[model samples]
Target chain A: MAKPACKNLEEIFRTPHGAVYQCNRANCFWLEFAGGISAFKASDFLHLKKQVEQIDVPEMVQNTARMADIVILNPFRSERCFVLTVTDVLNLRELLQGAKVMLDLNSMLYDCLHAMAV
Target chain B: MKDLLRLRTSLTEEIETLLNEQIKVEAHSSSVYLAMSSWCNRNGFDNSADYFQKQSGEEREHMLKLFGFINDMGGRAISPEVTNIPQEFESFRAVFETALQQEIYVTQQFNRIADRCFKAKDFMSFQFIQWFLKEQIEEEYIARRALELFDVIGEEGTGRWEIDKQVPKIKYEN
Candidate 1:
């Protein structure tokens, strides 16, 4: 039921050029890149994040001699391969970590609810 | 300030992820059993084929049960992408050995999920997984018994044929 670019999505991670939102209706994560958006399943979303995190930005930055070697994050969508720099990698990692924390917090509350129930 | 995340579903992200993982495990088990069944059929073990086929069906049932529970609880139930199911096994006895190993793996996974549920204080999910824990007992028992046939009957001459005949009749009473 969640169409792309709709306010219905819950923002999980946000950056300057992009943000990742969870759409419970579709049970998928929507990655908002630029003015456009694309959807990825939960596993795929995690996979993408892992791939991004595995990129050694500092190493790349130094190896490329201060010029960004363009870390591209493609999410099954042809157009939205996220182009990144060393700084952008750090920001993306921060956003993903924040989102993961929120997700864990939500899960923790749900788990606690059962214990509180008589 | 608004709890938009929980607005759509009561299932939390951790529990959902665990359930999806279990689904994939069940699907993988099903595929492995089906492959075993086919291998048995090819090897002229008729009774063994039937037993493996039944096991495959039961594994698929387990997958569906978890899938239904996730959807019923307003969580997303992912249709797992199963991979790396080995088509060729070493020998006849090796199949049951592999089966026992798989069941033990499944029990271990369920235990991990239950531990997470208890740690999170999610008794509902913990209670839900109890059925699977019990079922694993029967699964492991049958698999062990089936492997014992290879030892008891001894695969010398007609021993394997006799073992194949007994495979379909092996049952757990309680």
Candidate 2:
């Protein structure tokens, strides 16, 4: 037996800034953002999505403080840190939301298929 | 390709979100009960304070039970940050009234979650919450009985003292 040289990745969602992929072989999600790819387990991915959704976008836009210009996310079990600006946060939110909807659709479809198979 | 999402968790995203919200509710209820305990203690209602402290601990136990279930099902269980706990009471009677109201609210929340579980066809989660739904009956009964003591004892001269003494004795049998 031979292991596949390339990752068995399925594109979940993509935007001009980045994209997300589901790695079937690794059983994790690959986030293509900030000019690199970072892997997150399913739970970690959902956690990241929640963190992104909680960002105060309006406050970020209104606050002039240098520290308030960006927010950082350090995903669990990953060395990468996402330092996101207001625009980056918006883009990431869009990406993650799209991916979540697709994942939910996939699950529903799977249930339907399984029921039909039976 | 593999169904990675299904492989990751037995809970649907909707059910998981509802469970997390319920976790927050439980944490909030625990904090509220602890605040009530402190108010009762400060007002010289020793037995009532002890009763509320016990209620607070039970609510925390309920929260941990939900937390464990979420994690066991492979869903992310968030440790909720509770806020807005009231520390002051208007009067002695107000405390038991608030307790009864809080129990009612908790029962309503559990009913909503159970309904959502049924709609989503998540029978496992529905079955898990039945314990809480049934427990709410006893909780509401105890709180209601404690409140009714104010009317029975007549909060005039020694009524408050008598009510405080009897508060801890109130129990839900069967």
Candidate 1 per-residue lDDT over residues B1-174, each given as its tens digit? 234345545566678789999999999999999999999999999999999999999999999999998888767798999999899989999999999999999999999999998886678888999999999989988999999999899999999899999988888889
> What DockQ does each listed candidate score?
0.14, 0.68
Off by over 4 Å in 2: A1-7
Which of the CAPRI classes, incorrect, acceptable, medium or high, describes model 2? medium
> CA lDDT, every prediction?
0.81, 0.90
**What is the docking quality class of candidate 1?**
incorrect
* Chain B TM-scores across candidates: 0.96, 0.98
The deviation in Å at residue B133 for candidate 1 is 0.7
Just chain B of model 1: what TM-score? 0.96
| Per-residue lDDT of model 1, residues A25-72, tens digit only | 677777665466778766566657667778887678678554557677
TM-scores for candidates 1 onward, in order: 0.72, 0.92
B7, model 1: CA deviation in Å?
2.7
